[model samples]
Target: MLEQHATELLRHTVEETFPLAREVMTLDARQYTCPERFAQEKQQIFSRVPLVLAASCELRKPGDFKTVEVAGIPVLLVRNREGTVHALLNACTHRGAAVASGCGSAARFTCPYHGWTFAQDGDLVGIASSTDFGAVDKTALAMKRFPVTERAGLIWVILDPDSSHDPADMLGGIDELVAGFGFAGWNHIESRTMHGPNWKLTFDAHLEFYHVPVLHRETFGPERSNRAFYFSQGPHQRVVAPRGRPGDTAKDDLYALGRLPAADEPFDPLLVGEWILFPGASINTFYLNGQRGVLLSIVLPGPDVGTSTTTQTFLAETPPDEVTRAAMEELCTFLARVVGDEDLPTSALQQKALATGLLEHVRFGQNEGGLQHFHRWLDDLLKADDAELAALLAEPCPQR
Candidate 1:
């Protein structure tokens, strides 16, 4: 975040502490309910734009790899023996069967269909029954690769092979703001997937703190203010909530941390709140048993507008001690309850209501600038003309 932006937000926070009427934003219901729009989004926005695919820590070392699907395209990400990351189509060169699934450290991957093997760099190294199968150029058959750029301990990939946009152009130096979080040194603890309705609804929930006092009442508690300070780089954004209550007497373990930070200590506020790495990923802070933890929220869009998936990854700055490990486990369980019990269930109901078409559009308050900015960015891409769209795609897309 720029110093000017930070100061401006602080000023707003101070002013908004009172009961002031703020401008509100209207959002269309079909944005979440229409299948045709979803399909278009899958093609024009999701496929063409550079998305934050994973935290660089997910591939910790040489030969470490993870597989994910983006815009319904199977992606294989690997760090080669020389420590470079490769993002390639997970399809096998032989028959298009995925050569890998999940995460692990593997010297090479072999297609299960016919046992064709490839190294981490997608080099075809072995082919079974060569005499009978005939000879082909192995180099020509390397797994189809995608455009992948890495910066600030994060990996971004464009799902469309033909798209030439750079992820750094999407980031536009926003990485410098949160690079201080030490994500590069964070150790990935665990990942669990859950189903949700509409990627936008789920993402919208993460972008604002407005629902905290109500929806998260049992989790975040009512005393905490339901407000957020917004900072964005292009379509990517970061929402900062107040770090902790200085003099409160509540035991609110928000972020699923079993305890709160000592309010007396001089602390940095920017590192304290939620960061949305847009398209799908959030970096949130947590402190459990006195050890720092980061909750990496990766939102995976499902086959249609009606469904979506979320991958919540827990990370620690260092390997946790037994006590800290136990605290983390407890935090994980609490997070499951909060999301599965509170968040997604409500989003599913919201989806159901939106599908009724009774409401044409909903509103977002002035404080919800992040959500407004996101929708506007989406609309711009979806509504751009031929030449305008091409030029938009070619340039850096950090939102003003």
Candidate 2:
């Protein structure tokens, strides 16, 4: 499916407004600035959604773990000795202190505030001065757990403790699409976090190509195309834009196949594109000295409407060699500069400007279908009653 569409996308990009949508849509600027709406979204969008937390390769071994705070909820994502990833509340059951911080392999997480220890599975296995406690119920003291699904090289979690939402519920058949890239086999190269504006504003940077040639021109080159081809599956979106001139399909077997070139392929060319996991995540292909790398990223909301934190992780088919390491560092440095020096600073200013109440509405053209899909779904979910939400949740996602 991607191959067929990629071929079509390459052909389409030769023309202007290559993949136009049905209509232009305008959103109220409040969608970017209203604190009340932002509060509702924290529940309807961020809390309820199955969020992509990390790549599977980031937790390939037993005891491997990573921690993140999503929408102000601290999460401890761990791979147990059984080789299953689980999302547990980072707070200790004893005194409500954080049980862990950062990422690494650990035998058990012991709270820094106290000596309370928890296994990767969230079992409250040890407590300081147990004799003094006099028969506390260990089972009842277990760390709260959230639903998690590890699929297609990604770890997804629904922050709700009792959530039934699986990765399939949010991703539809997108996991099948991602599985083709073999991200699980890739070696982790870099992982870093950056501060940004409101979560939505930071996210808006990932949804369209309208600013690509202008905002990213210094890094992306002069011939980069502004036109984008968008493919939406339910609330998620995929974006394809021109990297350079389209490849000659008949000139080689790889291009003829209309697929993204493999890591070892002599040439890494633009073919199939990038993805936006609904809410605030993105999976994109990267090139480091002509070698292929994969990036998985997420923008997380902070304590309120005005602040956000972003984490980006890069991986390669294998651990980098000396020359490849230099290339990887150069590519990552360039990405950091373009995002920090360019995209993020501008988005942060947009957030500040939106809060001034000067503009009541903002417009989105056909080119911004990704943003439209997100905000529209948010509106629908916010207006829904519990029953309505359940029925909507049960509705089959459009895989095509």
Q: Choose the strongest candidate by lDDT.
A: 1
TM-score of candidate 2 relative to the true fold = 0.89
Worst lDDT run of 10 residues, candidate 2, spans 246-255
- Model 2 misplaced regions, further than 4 Å: 10-17, 242-271, 384-400
TM-score of model 1 vs. true structure: 0.88
Clashing pairs for predicted structure model 1, backbone only: 234-398, 234-399
Q: Report the lDDT tens digits of candidate 2 across residue range 32-54.
A: 77789888988877777778899
Off by over 4 Å in 1: 9-22, 246-267, 384-400
Lowest summed lDDT across 10 adjacent residues in model 1 is found at 249-258
| Model 1, position 234: C-alpha lDDT score | 62
TM-score of each: 0.88, 0.89
